[model samples]
Target: MNEFPRMSVRDTFARDWYLFRLDLLLAGMPNKKVAEIRKDLRIELAQAAQDGEFRQALAGLGPVNVLASNYLEAHGRKVPRVWAGLVAFAVLLYGWLLGVISLIEGLYSAADQIRPDATVEVVRNWLFVQARVVAGPEGVDSIGFSLSGWGLLGWLAVLVIVPLICASVWRAWLPRPTADQAQRA
Candidate 1:
């Protein structure tokens, strides 16, 4: 039998971390492979624990642990096909929400153009009528608000900038692995 290489504290922690993610990826795979990988990782973790290094390494990996836990909880029960379908459904739902909001705004604008006395009730009724035509019985009365040109521009800016900010924050939180670390995995 081939013996695995002895791993230092840091190396062991990194290995275990990667293996945990791998296990999640392979959750629905064969039990034999999962057990084998878990056994190996436990052995490494045990050795690191004997030297008090496992706790230290785990302290440094708090963020990674949180991320991994969230990922597994969100995705573990889902196969790739189901995961993709769920994502598509979410996207479609979001688009529909935006379309409905846009349509309501458009109706309010149209009502304002036609009836100078475009009270909130007029906009609400107009939206309800148009929504009934498009969305049938599912349509409900919605509150509406108007945006000034600057306010609309500000909203647009937020829509574009929020994702960029989130991407930057994510990149900062998880630094790129060094070349050697990448190769080790």
Candidate 2:
């Protein structure tokens, strides 16, 4: 009997995790073809596992991004990385919010320092949002925050940052060059 040694649970887990991530990154691929490729990969992985080279085999396949790109290119499909784009959008939105908050806080603190209890109005009116930090002799009396409209900077941000994000997502969407091609470039 020529029985191959079974892989340890850790090794099995490592292989399974890699394949699972590969499966996720292979989105936009034809289900049947994707299944076929995954099946074939499993067979190859099984052989490598018997030799206790499971991790190395997984690494040899390359990063999930490049591997997915290769498969996608072979199938003649250029699928946009929708998930990544969405994530980027979310991060930008939240980051901008944080920036606005910090700006308002700093302005208020500065005013408080210059005129501790004096009547002061710190208004930062942007294209769409208008923020007013008012302080009376008794310190900060009221905080006024409103969404007026998209300011010039807001439009500029949309124009500049948005295209850059799209270009980035698209660039990431496109197939990556092989190591040799990259070296040459």
Candidate 3:
């Protein structure tokens, strides 16, 4: 006959405790509160018998879906606002990065138009024409590129700085987490 090692009462409790905590989190119980509640439950479970009694006690907590539903329905408003801000930030960042990439691509396209066979004067004249069409009558000024490095640097700064600024603003606009939400963190 083969013998298998029996699971300890503590081990059984630990496994059930972990599963319960996960269900609570998925149900929207904040992290801090979940830990506290779990601690209290562990003490209760330890006092109970390790056989059917412990299992029954765990089942009495109710189903996982009910726990999650209760938390989300109570905090639905705050959750949607957080999700909206995150989505807005994502959209803005994507648009900004796309604009920057398009600008770089346009510059490359103009450079490619210049052939090795073309004379310097011809190249300069062709570029002048292309710039006027692409950058408007103001040419380089319209495209924000000057002989000095400031044009590229300034736009780069805008690209990097804007997202951070918007993110800070979004965070500030959010409602403070409630006692319940904080527990669910």
Best by TM-score: 2
Compared with the true structure, all predictions reach lDDT values of: 0.50, 0.72, 0.49
Q: TM-score per candidate, in order?
A: 0.38, 0.54, 0.35
Winning model by lDDT? 2
- Stretches off by above 4 angstroms in model 2 are 1-6, 113-185
Could you give candidate 2's per-residue lDDT for residues 1-185 as a string of tens digits?
53556778887788788888878877756678789988888888888888878889988988877887788777655663555555667776777677678767877786666765568788886435577888876677667667634575675576467756775767666777677644432
In candidate 3, what are the lDDT values of residues 26-115, reduced to their tens digit? 433355655665666666655554453666666675675565455555653233233344555577557756655565556645644543
All predictions: root-mean-square deviation over Cα?
14.5, 7.9, 11.3
lDDT of 1 by residue, 26-145 (tens): 543345645765676567666666676876644544564454444334433223222343444456447646776777767655544444322334433221123311221223234444
> Which parts of model 3 are misplaced by more than 4 Å?
1-70, 76-80, 116-185
List residue ranges in candidate 1 displaced over 4 A.
1-24, 55-79, 116-185
Ranking by lDDT: 2, 1, 3
Candidate closer to the true structure by lDDT (higher is better), 2 or 3: 2
Candidate rank order under TM-score:
2, 1, 3
Error of 3 at 52 (Å): 11
